[model samples]
Every structure is written in structure tokens, then in C-alpha cells.
Target chain A: MSDQQQSGGAAVASSPPVGETLMEVTGVSKVFGGLVAVNDVNFIVPRKAIVSLIGPNGAGKTTFFNCLTGLYRPTTGRVNFDGTDITAKRPDIVTQAGIARTFQNIKLFRTMTATENVEVGMHPRLRSRVTGMILRTPFVRREEKAARERAREILSSVGLKRMDELAMNLPYGDQRRLEIARALASEPKLLLLDEPTAGMNPQESEELRTLMERLRTEQDISILLIEHDMKVVMNVSDHITVLDHGEKIAEGSPQEVRQNPRVIEAYLGSQA
Target chain B: MRFLASLRSGRDTVTGMIPGWVLAVVLIVFAVIFPYLVGSGSFLDASTQTLAYVIMALGLNIVVGFAGLLDLGYVAFYAIGAFVIGWFGSQQFPDVNGGKGIHILASDRATFQPKLSGGRLDIAGIHINFFIVLFIAMAITALWGVLLGAPTLRLRGDYLAIVTLAFGEIVPRVFENSTSGLFGIGSTDFSHGRQGITPIDKINLPWSHDLLYSDANLKPAYWVALGMVFFTIFVNRRLRDSRLGRAWIAVREDEVAAASMGINLVRTKLWAYAIGAAFGGFAGVFLGTYNNTVNVDQFEFGFSVFILAMVIVGGMGNIWGVIVGAVALSMMNRYGLPQLNSLSEPLGFDVTSISFGIFGFFLLIMMVLRPEGLIPSGRRRLELREAEIEGSEDTGAVGDMSQMYEVRQ
Candidate 1:
């Protein structure tokens, strides 16, 4: 429990943010016809912090993330990202404004090699357009070279040894790592990982925890996560926000969130 | 050389076991001497036509193969490109010159002249050089591409195909009907209606003094067509590895993921149409000049379907596969079924008339035997295999794979 308090001491959402706020969500909700998947969730992600959004199944955790990332426009709400009014800006715009996400199902381009997938991640950063590609100008060549080197460096950083292997051919854990590598290749200041440890073993989850910490400290990147595992949620997050039926029930340090009565009731009621 | 090597490196990424460099050199040598080996007029003409189709297939490959846009009416750009030549390179519209011909880049020392007497109008026809018209055609077709792609931005799958097919059909008919401008929107006669334009100028280099598209010796035309084919292949190869191409493939694979990675789908899809349409227009100029006509009848839905078949049969994303597919199908259309006259003697049916059915048969066979295509790209082959695997796995249950793959209503 002290581990949770020590980790959360760096940044807490309830208190005025220690770092500049990177994203601000106000009353964000999503309704699917008859179903309200998410409802009136307000939260903030501070700069260079790992924030966890934890909720039980169908609690609208993913839906909340989707709203923030513009996969689905919030039924009614506003999201400001890095000083830009990014509400309902398409996913590409969201990414260009420094937010990149990975799918929960791991949607890697199955046919392209791992490196190629990473190269695709670097698309927004690439300067050469169609004409330069056809002309094969010196600048295009140099850009391509820089992109390849960066893509390769990202792959090795993610512990994916083989850049040439097709994405689908990689082991399950490696495929997950490759997806992160691809997201990192975008040079995103804010990374929204759907579930970095979802389907990962204990050892793999440990590696992911260390990796997330390194990403926060070394790369100076903020991470927003939808994590189910308490181990990851408690150990890695500087701030924890629990969502139930798309409503934010608790927002504070991990230790404070753990002792919240509403958080317990929401999980137990949903399970029952 | 590194850039060039990367252009031809698609296959190497998949299976680089073979030394393709030697194979490429041999193929180039064979292509350089192809006209001389069979100096016969008919053969040269057939191959030149095939090369023209090759340019079109490469262009369409960018749309359907790389971008995964199922465009059924790609020939619209070709018609527009051909008209660029028809309007500018020939004397189709005579009022523009005020009875004086427009001749730039024409040979000065030679006495050769265009046939200006046979126009449908009494006004003297203008004749600009072929080189300038080529660029104009590309620009026009590229503009039309953006225009056509505008409505299809929000559409996908068969719906996108229907809209594009409609656009394709509309262009030629407008060209056919707009003898005195579009629906009375303008005063000039853009096309000659059903009668069509004629006497398109031959392919003329800036330095050439003679009409090179004559039937007596088509060697120059062959070289010109071959040069365009090389240009098409080179551009196609370079594009296949570019960031734009990667974005196309990304959009094709998963649009949401690609967008999340910061690829603007609208811009990517439009670029595919514009660049692809430009290539179609490039070949259109050559085809219009080589055929010596730009008739409305030549622009048909069937020609679009024929080009689509070449792309499908060759291999969707593979540039080499598309080229081989175009050449093979074009040759077969010209010579294959005709050579099967012996089948007519035995079956008591005209084999030549059933050429389309034979083509259908070949397509059916290719689909049944090798659905991935003749030279399947690594990506397409994997897609086909995954589909196959999913098909078998689904058959074991009640829900079919087709249901999942079907476009959302």
C-alpha cells in the first residue's frame, strides 16, 4: 500500500496538478441508441504522468477512451488536449495533436513486416509527399533513411528483435510489443494504451510496468491507460480514476481510490 | 541506384532468395529487341496496345490494390486523357484558331502536315504539338479525379463502386452528347457527339520531322510505348515504397488504426485517385494518337471492366504482376482466342466470337485455382489465405465468413 502512495505522490488529479494538464475532459458521455455506454465522466491527465482508468466489464472504460480519442464523438461533452479544443476532431487530428492509441484487439497490419508497421506510424512525420516519392529526391531519401532508423530503434527498444518479421507471425507478446513500438514511432507526447497488460503473463506485465515507467521518466511521455489488472493499476499509475457505467466514481491517489466505498460498491454490484 | 533498387524491392522483401537483378537485365534486353524479332505490323500493333493497357493497370493498381478502393469506372480518366489529345493535338475544334492552326513544337524543316481538311466543321482546326497536350491531359484527368473522388470520400465497398461506375458512365456519355457544349451550359462544341473525333496526330518528338505512327513501320511507336511503360513501372515501383503508399496500405488494412496513426484518409484516398488518374491520362494520349482516333464508342464500361480484370488476374498490389496481367490478357484478347479457330472446327461454334466467355472461363479458373492472382503480392496473398482460413473455420459453425465480410448496411 505504501508503494501505491509513493508512486501516486508524484502527481494527483484531485489536488491541483503538479504538472501542466495535458488533457481535460468535461462531462464526456456516449450513448449507443438505447444504451448509455459512458456518462458524464470528467478527468485530467497531467504532463509526464501515468493515469489509469479502471472499471469492470461494460463499465464504459473503453467508450470513455474512444470519446477522448475521437473514435466516437461524445454524445455531449468537451475535450481540450494540449491547449487545443480537440472535441470531435477526427482520430488523425487527435494523433497529429500529439495523442496516439493502440487497439485492445491488437490491429497490426498483418501482412506488413514489423518495421513497415512502424514506418506507417511515422507517416505524419514524413516530409516527402507523392511527388518526392516519384522523383526520389535527395531529401525524400534522407527522410526515408531517418524514418527507417527511428523505426528500427523503436522496435529494439520494445524488445522486438526482428524488424523484418511479419506482424502476425510474431509471438503473441511480441505482437503486443510491436503495437506499442508502432505507437511510439508516432513520437506521441500522449499515449493511450487500451490495455498494455491485457493477455500478458505476470512476467510480461512486469516488463510492461518497467517499460511504462521508463517511457514516463526517460521519454517524458504521458500515458493514459484502461487497465483491468490491479497490480498494473496500483503500481504504475500516478493518478487513478475509476469509471462505472461511464461515470467517474473516484479520482485520487491509488491508496485513496482503494479505500473509496463507491468504487467497491460499483464493482461488487456489477459482478453480482 | 539505391532508390531504383528500392523500387524493384517489393519481391525481395517477401522472398529475396533469387537474384532478380539478372532477371531484370534479361527482361530489359528482351524488351529492347522485341520489335525487331517480329517486325510484322500486326504483332507490333498488338504489343503496343498491350503496353497502353499496361499503363492503365499500373494506375488502377494504385487505387484498388494499394488503396483498397474498389473503383469500377477507372476508364473515365482514360477517355478524358484521350480527349485532351483529341481537343488539343487534332483539329476537332476549329473556331479557336480563327482558321489559323496552332502549331508549337512541330518540326520546322520538314514539309509534313496534319490532315486538316476532314474536320466536321468549316472552321480551320488548331494543331498544338503532342508533347504539350500530354501534360494538359494529365492535369485535366487529375482534376476530374479529384472531382469524382469528392462524393466517394464517405463511401466504401460496393457503394463506392456504384458511384464510381456511375461517374465513369456519365463522362463518356457527356462526351458523346455534348456536341454543342454540356447540356447547353457552354457555347463551344467539346466533342463531335456520336460521330467522334478523328485524325489524331501521331506521336511526335520535338526533334522528329516525320509522322512516326504510320503503319509502314511501327518500330518508333513500339519504342515510344515501351518507354512510357518503363516510366509507368518506374513510378509505380517508387510509389509502392513511399510514405504515401504505406498510408494507402494502412488505410486499406484498417482505417481507424491508420487515422489514429495520423494518416488523413481523405487526403490519402484523393492522392491515389489523382496520381492514378494522371497515369491513365498519360497512356490515353498515346492510345488516342496510336489509334488515330478518339471516338466516344471506344470509351465503354466494358473497357473499364477489362482493365479491372487485368489487375485482378495479374495480382492486385504487385506492380510486376499487374504489368504481366495487362500484357497477358491484352495478347489473349488479340491473339489467343483467334488462334483457337481449331476449337471452332470441332465444336461447330465460332471460337473468336466466344472470346469473352473464354476470358470468363480463365477468370473463373484463376479464382478457383489461385484466387490470389498470377503474381500475388505478399500482402494480397496473406489476405487471401486469412480469408480462406476464416472461411473453413466459419464453415465448421453456423455463421459464414461472407456475413462478416459483407459491407454494413
Candidate 2:
């Protein structure tokens, strides 16, 4: 197959229409003994939209993200992703089912090269088995070459340089971008980013915000962002869900959620 | 400062001067002609044994080094491999199919049994070809590897090491005691008890009528071992660069991140164990055939540690490093200690008696001075020095949340 066909066909540039639910989390509650991490959280990510889940510390934003991504089995809930119930599936199965995620702390394969980290993300998609790998059959060789090329393309697309550098050796901001590049390598329908811009400078965060927009509009991917940076959340989110101590207290467009009294109270305190 | 500079660029000077493939070719050519150059039968025999150890060390490197699974009982696979040859390549089983031995693709020499039924020559045991038995050993050991690895899926670090250690210990004892077959269920004798199976069929190609080199020549055995080592190296390099290899590394790096990336941790790790054990078995068959014995005494815990030391000392996760480690350690045990015996004789001491103690000291020094090994993989080196490098670079990094936590406290 031609290089264009390999990288282009899978991810067509046509943006998915809005209002179609890419992921629907209904009545999803996670109970760790008596402590309720995520309590009956009903959430939806529209197609090709950058949806934000924002809250104060201990508000279960990351827990809710984990439930959506199949990292944690919800105590009571159903997570339907793109018309399939992916509730309580293994993380690998969830990724195979077209949902990919980045961690709160950068979890790039530190020992591996930047390209290798991305290639690993392409694991679920590649079909070369052990025999083929050992023999280096033409099919396996072709597949491996294509995966490397695509990894390079994804890394470049994410605005990352130094493709040969170790993931741990890359600058902190580049590490964050590499994480997204890796997540993108899985060809996920829904992308979950946990604090993607946590330690980035304002300039880097701005670039990431633009990249998130491009990912939605150009790649037809839906993003579920759990971020503390209100500027990024308010700027990129098509819709926002605000949680306070495990319960969803507010939900609407950025402006509406920003103006909500309960959202302000959650962020500030009861007196506010 | 000069010492540190040399340490950093020492490996690079040789590697950078010659292309990697060229270096590999030179090594291969040297290895091919080594038996002739050595000439002495004892030295060739020791070299062959060292090559077998190389295969085993490379095998263990797969699980312990690449996949970061500490396997303390790698000798279990070795025991299984040796026994495979003992069962299939020996006259351990006398009564099979009414005493007409099951011989499949075996050499004519191996098929010839004593005269029976009016002076008619007949085979009386299962005599499979050496090459076929090698594969069988690998397959059986791989299956056992998966089975043993299944229970340790949830285990990590010390717990995983302990479980594998138990398995390693149990297999050899079982073979030693299973004189009346497993659990005394059948009349089939698994092992010939403590005496072990000896005088196993010699190695021969199915097509070649003449017996392959044995104790008298030893060159053929050395060549065979060298060939297996080459195969093991080829397989190891391929697996290290393949998709499954990447998955193994990812799992080793961070299980949660790897799982999130859609890598099946269970299967990836099991593949490491199975492939690792298969190589162990591959070498085991060769060692058994070459030594002309499959004794339970050979599969001891110390042997497992011996192989592990090769991996650790040579450099874990580096194929060439492991091979060097195996050769160095095996030669030290074989030639170095014996050579040292002459010096120690007048002093009324033996170096071989305190070999393990010396080895322990060497390991402790390696751990303290160069924990990654004498030659570390590039990735491992980076990991070992991550703190040093990171501290120097990326000072612009923010989010020192630990300080915040301390303030709150």
C-alpha cells in the first residue's frame, strides 16, 4: 500500500457533526468502601467536541474520567461509547474499542524512544504476531514501517521535535505533547486528557489548546479533558460539566457553567 | 573527570568505529573458526558448554531484563528441556507398542535395538531426531512456562521471584522422585531416579549416516552450539524490536500506562516467559546431549543464580552483553578456577570452593559501581542516570506540589 493510503484512509479529514453523543456515562458511581469517588455522574461527550470536566481538588474529575476509560469499574453505571456499552471493560479492551487516554502525570514509556512510545500506542491496531515478527515476513515489515512513519507523522502533528530522544529526556512540555501523540496513535474515537497542560508555560498551554481544537475539527476526534487550568477549560470546551465532592453540580456551555452560582461556590467555598 | 569521560565514551569508541553489522559479522566468523583455533578437546567442550550457557542467559534476559519480571527459577525450564531429550532420545522407555520402539525420523544408529523374535533387529524406545527433539523441548518448556507464569500474573517484584523460585525447586525434585511415573499412576518411568539417564543417543542428522562429532572430536558439538547461539541471538534481536517487544517494554515501564495503551499485560508478559523458557529449553537439550547425561543434580538453585549472574553482570536487556557475561562466567568456572588451582595448591586452598563467594563479591561491586551491569542498554543507562540528567536539564519545570503538601502538613 502507498504511504498516503496507510496514514490518510483511517483518519479522514471530515469533521464529525456536533450533538451526536460519542460517549454517554449515566448513573456512574464509584464507591471505595464508604468513600464515594464518583457519585451517580451523568456525563456526555458530543461528537468532535472538546468537552471539559472541571472541579476543585477531591471533586472526582479524574475518577469520572477513569470510569469512562475503563480503568475503574463503576459501582453503578453504564458507559455507552459510540453506540457500544464499554462499561467495566479492561483498559486494553477499551483502547481497542476506540477510546484512548493520557495520564494525569505524564506516563510516557520513559526508557523508550519518543517514536517507540508512539509505536507502542499503535499496539492494538497492528496485527503482526510473534512468528511473523521473528521471520520478518514482508507483511510484518510493511506493517512495522508504516507504524513508524505514522508515529513520526503523529509526533510532528502534535508539534513535538526530537523524535529520537528518550521520552523522559524530552522537555517537560514536549513530554505532555508526546503523551497526546501516543494517545492519537491508538486511533481513538474519544481522547481523554488528564491535566494535559499541568506544568506547561502559558505559551505551551496556548499551543495545546489550539492543538486540541485542531484534533476535534480536523481529525474528527472527541476529547474529554480533565483540567485544573480554568483558562484552558473555559477556552476550549464546547460544553462543561462542573463537579463538587463527587456529584455533578453544574452542566452547560462554558459561559453558563462559569456563571452558575454552585460552580463558583464549589471553586471558592460555601460562603462564596 | 578523566575516568568519567572514558567511562562515557569507552563503548562508543569501538562501536562507532565499526558499523554494528560489520562487528557482528566479524564475531560470527571468529566464533565459527574458534574450535579449530583452540584444537584441544577439553577447551572445545568447555566452549560448547559456554555457548549453551549463552543461550540460557539470553533466554533469561527476555523475562528478567526486557519484561522486567524477576524469574528466580529459570532452571525449571532447563530441567524440563534436558528431561525431554532423556525421554525422547534415550532408552528410558523399554515397552512401547509391544516392545517395537517408537522411532520417528531417527538416525539408523539410534533405531538399532538388540535382536528379538528369531534374530530380527528391532527398535525398542522412542528415538526422535535431535533437531526435532530440540523443538519439542522448546514447545513443552514454553507450555510449562505459561502454566507456571499464570499463577504469578497478579504478583510483582519479590512475590513473583519467590513463586518462580518454588517452581524451579519443585520441578527438579519431582523429576528425581518420579521413578514410578507422576503420582505413581502409571508404570512409565519419568526419570531413572537419582542415577539419572546416561549414554543418551548421540547427535546425528537424519540424512547423514555417520554419527555427528561426540566426545572424541567435540568440534561438531561446538559448531552446533554456536549455530544455536546465533539463532537465539537473531530471535532475541527481532523480538526486542517487534511490536510484542515494545509492548513488553511498555508493560515494564508502567503497567497502567501500558494497559491504557491497549497492551494486554497478561499475554505480553506470558509471551516473555514462554519465549524465555523456550530458549532455556533449547540450550538444555544441547547441553544434555553434549554432556551425555540428564541428571537431577544438574538442575540446582545455584545453577539458576549462576545464569542470572551472567545476565546481571554482562548487562541485563543487552543481548551481546548477556552473551559476554555467560562466556566470561562459564570460562571463569571452567578454565580460570582450574588454572588458579595450581597457585592455591601450595597454599593449601582451593579457589573453586569459594567461587560463589567470589561471585557474590563481584555482583555486590557491580551493583554499587555499575548497577546497570558491565554494559547497560542505552535505555537502562538513561533510567539509571535520569535523576542526574533531569536535575541538570528542565529547571524551568514548575508544579512543585510536594512543597505545597509539606506546607499544608
Which predicted model would earn the best DockQ? 1
**Model 2 regions lying over 4 Å from their true place:** A1-18, B1-8, B110-121, B339-351, B387-409
Candidate whose TM-score is highest: 2
Model 1 / residue A38 / CA error / Å? 1.4
Candidate 2, position A143, lDDT: 100
DockQ scores of the candidates: 0.46, 0.37
TM-score quality measure for candidate 1: 0.90
Q: Assess candidate 2 and give its lDDT.
A: 0.86
lDDT tens per residue, model 2, B235-338: 99999999988998898777778989999988999999999999999999988887889999999887888899999999899988888899999999898887
lDDT by residue (A14-36, candidate 2, tens digit) is 12225988888888998878998
TM-score of chain B of each: 0.86, 0.90
